[model samples]
Target: MKQQSEMILIGGGLIGLSLAVELKLRGATVTVLSRNQQEAAGLVAAGMLAPQAEQIPSGPMLDLCLRSRALYNDWTRKLEEMTGLETGYWPCGILAPVYERPDCTTLPQTPETPSYWLERDAILHQQPGLGNDVVGGWWFPQDAQVDNRRGLIKTLQTAAQELGVTIIEGITVEKIVTSPDQKVTEVQTNQGIFRADHYILTTGAWSGELLSIPVYPRKGQMLSVRVPDDFKSLPLQQVLFGSNIYIVPRRDGLIVIGATSEPVGFTTGLTPQGVETLLSDAIRLYPILKEFPIQEFWWGFRPETPDLFPILGPSSWDNLTLAVGHYRNGILLAPVTAQLIANWVLNAQTDPLLHHFRSDRFQTLR
Candidate 1:
């Protein structure tokens, strides 16, 4: 009989909790240490699972996102089956509206999910409420969204707990204690020192604080609005990806509008300019949004690398893995990240998909 691997996962965000659930399902005893689970970026995200809509050039990052998007249907279904919770996994698709002439040069179209240009009348018929400047747009039928705050985050937490993954909240990991042989022996936290057979860092934006990784916080401010019950028409059925803004509508009349990409370091609070700009751009994209009442105001820090890609696979230290710096795609990439990390930890199998996202990729650039 084989012994179960004892794993300690630092960070209890969506990425950490998802990975913890995966590790537990793979016969590993997992414990997750979360600093502040409520403040996790996943909780604050608008949960747009957009690859083509994001206009990512054809590359490894785009490939990673599309692969994760492919796994979402099965992944969310399994989680709901196990925990009996809905993750708000809506394959509602996305419409990238253009104020000027439509151009498909920047958008990468995959054979599995090809995006096509929609004429002005066609787009208006599909989604009626649009600003007057809107002409035509590209339709990404495969792009989808999840209600991260209201659905997926809570569902993932429930799934992890139901699967017997020990999650310790409010405990901050101060440092990673390594030995002379470059193996993580234990983690030094505010509470005390804890040891595990393996350690995985999914700390998101704070990854650089504990290790020499290039992960840093990229701040984003977002807000949500809800349509009034007496509104004349139905709420938006699909996500609208406009210039520097996205409008994601939920089944329950809650529309999420975001965001601003500020390189500010861990700065908290929503600025007046940030909110103003979001509302200005959002209203211009969807004219009816101005009538919706503001529901919430918040912000979060995305873990970003210099190359704007994730740092996955093993780190320099033995028995320690890197799964941080997901930037804007943490919610979308959670399933694939969990699966790949679990495979490497339990079976020692490294998927070729992880080849471009290794922890040492930044070192080569230096």
Candidate 2:
């Protein structure tokens, strides 16, 4: 029997696996438990690190996203060297396209906030495939994406093994057994008993359901389609947004159309309504995409907290940590979350944002 662990991470998803790798690199003996065939939320994401584009105007989420965006280049390079996997990390930047409705009673806009405003003629010039009545947009040069599917799998499974971190899959953790001091002692699984000195949960949408996190699942159904042979003639130069819809194009000739946020807990299957909404809006935004053939269809859950941000940092337990509830931003935030968790573990300091996402925030709502 293993006596005790330097650390044990749960959920084998992006955050769990990334943190495990970081900890092991820092000399901690780490083990990651990944269970089920569930695509492990991060795997299904378009992996856009677009804080500047998705900026919520005001909140801790904006700051967290910016901090994470700042880390992408270095993080992707490190993962690539170790696993020889192309993370497809493109720093080509993102464009936040704006649509205007000709409102008669509206305040003047602020240009310093990084948004672009153009009339139909200019929009047609910039994006030849756009529909009529197009307005201008915002540009986020820092927003980028990783081929999250490849990145998560290679980073967690392949890179983790290369770094000597143990991965146990398909085993459900029944309970977290702890010492009298209330530190995480081990996790009991259906397969067997695995002991550890500390535990971190990165279970995504399953985080709250597993351990009463103030979290829930927000499902997004997305699809990928191949662009036309002449895709390059009027190809999208940046990630695009029209109204509430977003179209993300990859270098591999795959243009991804996504995604509607629905509150259906833990259900992976896509509904007719979900698919209709996404496809309809996608075609409306980029008329060229309508001619492309559909390549893949996917549905995933974003682990959302009440405040729509991740609940990270120390738990009430001496050695337990909360690194879940990242909701839609998990893929964007994974690397930075791993780095921050590693820093907290090494320095024993609590993140200031912990006050906002702490489990206690929900008791008041109840």
Query: Judged by lDDT, which candidate is best?
Result: 1
Q: Model 2 off-target regions past 4 Å?
A: 1-4, 101-115, 230-234, 351-355, 363-366
Query: Over the stretch 18-105, how does candidate 1's per-residue lDDT look in tens digits?
Result: 9999988888899898998666779768999998899888879988999999999999999999889899999999999999985443
Please, what is the TM-score per model? 0.96, 0.90
Please report how far candidate 1 places residue 138 from its true position, in Å.
0.5
Measured over all alpha carbons after superposition, the RMSD of each candidate to the real structure, in angstroms, is 2.7, 3.0
Best of the candidates, TM-score: 1
Q: Please provide the root mean square deviation of candidate 2 (C-alpha atoms, Å).
A: 3.0
Clashes of 2: 4
On the 0 to 100 scale, the lDDT of residue 354 in model 2 is 50
TM-score (C-alpha, index-matched) for candidate 2: 0.90
What range of 10 consecutive residues in model 2 has the weakest lDDT sum? 104-113
